[model samples]
Structures are given as C-alpha cells and as structure tokens.
Target: MSKVKKRIRPTKEQAQELNRRLDAVVEAGHTSNLYCDCDVCQALAEQAKLMGYRTDVTIKRPSDKWDRRKREYERRRQNDAVKMASLAGQGLTSAEIGGKMHRSKSYINKLAKEFEITLATKKRGRKLCH
Candidate 1:
C-alpha cells in the first residue's frame, strides 16, 4: 500500500505576505526577473511550485542582433536561389553548377527543387564506337 502525502497549506499571514511580495515585484517591473536566483524570487517560485503551479516564467524580448543576422542570412539565401535559377536558365548541368558554386550536385538539385527551377538532364559519357 502506498502512503498518501498530506499537502501543507499556507497560513493566512503567509498568503498575504506572498501576495504583497508578488505585487511589489510586478509594480517594480521585475516580472521578467522572476526566474532570478534571489532569495525572495526563489521562495516565491518554490511556493508556487508546491501549489501545483509553474515556477519558471520566461518573458521573451526581441534581440536586434539576432534579428539582423537572421535577415542577412535570409537575404543571402534568396540571392543564392536567384543565382542558381539564372545558372540553370543558362543550360548548365547540375554538376557544372555545383562546381561553379562550390556546392554538391545534391545541393544544386535541392535548390532547384526549392526554387521551382527546372534543371537540364542529359547523359554525359564517352561516345560509343559503331
């Protein structure tokens, strides 16, 4: 038989103190700092966790450096796709395009498929003697 654990409820004074601290933290614009390792924050987190609540709260803020880097990467990828499309339009085979772009034939094929650019498929080998 498993023994059941009794949940200890907080007293009225403790509940009021917790509410006051929470309000103060919120009014001080420290909600984002709730995940801090400070004594008060840790105590509050522990209490909330014991109450069957989530203690880890995250507030997401936009990062300008990350956003700028992402945009730059996207721009470079778009430009590469355009270049690949133009190269395909010039009747270059996948292997030739891969060599020129310093990429693999599979990469060229994937890019062609992604950009909806049709690539030429031709047989390349030594000519057979009759």
Candidate 2:
C-alpha cells in the first residue's frame, strides 16, 4: 500500500491575514496593471510562507536590447574619438590614421570634428625649410 501525504492549509483567520498582506502590496500596482517585486511584495511573500499559504511570484519586464546596444555604441564611439585624437596628436595625417585603424580618411575627419581635436601637422602659415 502506498501512503498519501496530506497538505497543510491555513485556517480561516490565517487566510484572511494572508489575504490582507497580499492586498496591501498588490493594490499599489493595481492602477498600472503591473505587480512589482518590491520590498512590500517580498515581505508579503515571506509572511504568506510563514502562515503556510501557497504563493506564486511573477515579474514582467520590457526588453532592454535597444537600450543596451545604444549604450555600447556610444561607448565605442567615445573610445574611437579618443584614439583618433591620440593619433592626430602624434603627427599622423587623417589618411594614415584611417589606414592604421582600417577606416576611411573622411570617417577619421568626422571623428576629429566630433571630438574637436586639432591635427598636429595642419599648420596654415608658410612652410619652414628645416
């Protein structure tokens, strides 16, 4: 003969108490059609567990892929700008700098403008004979 285990259930008073706790946390998000797992919800979950009440936790979130990609793109652009400025300061022409970085001279010029970097060899006056 196989033995079946009986499940423990909360008494009526315990049920009411657990319901009150859950209500306090869930009602805050009722207007927005969302339920957050904030501190209040966490406390409610803990209280329900202590009272032997079965609980289900659910969380919903929007996709962050676009936000993450935008952040990464910005970071890379800043790093590239810094590198372009460093190369320009080292007396490398835009074409040489672009070739070294596997980019076009125009793109290097664009980065230079964006970073407000002055090219080292772009003097406007008459050429010196040294």
Candidate 3:
C-alpha cells in the first residue's frame, strides 16, 4: 500500500501574522522592482517560515524587447569558444565535439568559423589526425 502524506497548517494567530508580513513584503517589492530570489527577499522568506508561514513567491523587473535581446546576447557570450577551438585543434571533428559537449554540429561549425579554426571533414565514423 502507498503511504499518504499529512499537511501541517498554521494556527489562526500565526496565519494572521504571516499574512501581515507577506503583504508588507509584496507592497515593498511592487514599488522597488525587487526580485524574490535576491538575498533580502530570501531573508524575508526565511522570516516567514520562522513565523509559521510557508509561501512561494516570484518577482521580476519590467523590461522591453531591446533589454531582453541584450540580456540574451550577454548570456550567450559566456560560452567558451576558445576552448571549443582548442578542442577542434586537437583533431576532433565538429560532430565529435558536438557529441562530447552536447551541442549541435552546426553550432560547432559556427563557433569554428567565428574563431577561425579549420575543421577536417571526413567519412562517417572515421576521425582525422591533426
């Protein structure tokens, strides 16, 4: 037989206190663009737990399309193209590197071209020597 789980609920007074604190936190966050995952918000979450409240919260800053595009590009820029090129220099084909790195062969080719690394194309299942 499968075991059933029990739920723990807060008492009335604890619930009231938790609600008051949560409202204040939400109100402050709305005006300040405060994200829930930040350190201050996380501390507020811990405080809520200590006060007998369990809550899940999420908050985000507003941004336009340009801001979103810039953030995406910055995130993509963190990839290790230099390391990819170094791996290619060690006689690994784009497909092999893609397999090892969990990336597509086309992405490997793009990185190779962007970094000026020459990849040797050979027959399937055959590796080229540098």
Candidate 4:
C-alpha cells in the first residue's frame, strides 16, 4: 500500500501572526521606498506580492546620460594612453613628457608601465674614464 501525506494549514492565531509579520515587512518596504527605491525594497515588494499582498513600489534605474558620460571619459583616457605610448617611443624622458603634457612625472611613468612602453632614463653626474 502507498502512503499519502496530508497538507497542514496554519491555525487562526498562527495566520494572524504571519499576517502581522508580512504587514511589518511591507511597512519597512514603504519606508525604504520613501528614501531610496533600491533593489532591497523591490525584493520586499515582490515578497509581499508572493504572500498575497499588493504593492505600488517601483525600482529606478541609472540614467542614459550618466552611462554616456562614463563611456566618453573611458574613451578619452584610452586616447591619452596611446599618446603617452607614442611620446615614450620617441625617446623622451617621463619628466620631459610630463612638462609637455602638463602632467606629473609619476603619472606619466605609471601610464607608461600600464601601456607596456619603455621610457628613456637620464644619466646623472660625470662618467669615469676606463
């Protein structure tokens, strides 16, 4: 013989307790939505819907203008890296390049390393005769 399992339902008091907890969560979602419409609040609203409650919360996404500005900034940075690599290939010291580009010598050296460019190093003091 096959055994069948019956489903157990919550009692009246347990149901009331569950409803109170759901209401508390929904209230918290409403408060969070008032401050910021972030992912956490959106998840809470979805949870309320799954628990048989309706919510009017909406999630806000980043604007297209912000994404465009970020992409432009990255493009300019890559162009500058190419320019720095060309300048390094021309046998110019980092200090000289920094002077021409109005950037710090350390900044130029960092970019050169990042772009795998070899820079010219200046020799200091007098050379000894063999």
Candidate 3 lDDT by residue in tens digits, 1-130: 8985444676788677666766776776743654456655665666665654444444445658868999887566446576677777788888988888888989888877876778767767857787
3 or 4, greater by TM-score:
4
Task: Specify the poorest-scoring 10-residue window by lDDT in model 1.
Answer: 52-61
For 12-124, candidate 2 gives per-residue lDDT tens digits of 88778778876886676643534456776766667766664534444446578877999998998898888888888789988888888888888888888888887655558
> CA lDDT, every prediction?
0.75, 0.75, 0.69, 0.71
In model 4, state the lDDT of residue 7.
Answer: 39
If ranked by lDDT, best first, what sequence of candidates would result?
A: 2, 1, 4, 3
What TM-score goes with each of the models? 0.48, 0.44, 0.38, 0.50
lDDT tens digits, residues 4-112, model 4? 5443554677557556655765776665444455555656555554444544545456568977999998797688788888888798999998888888999888887
Collision pairs in model 2: none
In candidate 3, stretches whose alpha carbon ends up further than 4 angstroms from where it belongs are: 1-78, 123-130
lDDT for position 38 in model 2? 77
Between which residue pairs do clashes occur in model 4? none
Candidate 4 ranges with C-alpha deviation above 4 Å: 1-58, 125-130
**Residue 25: error of model 4 in Å?**
15
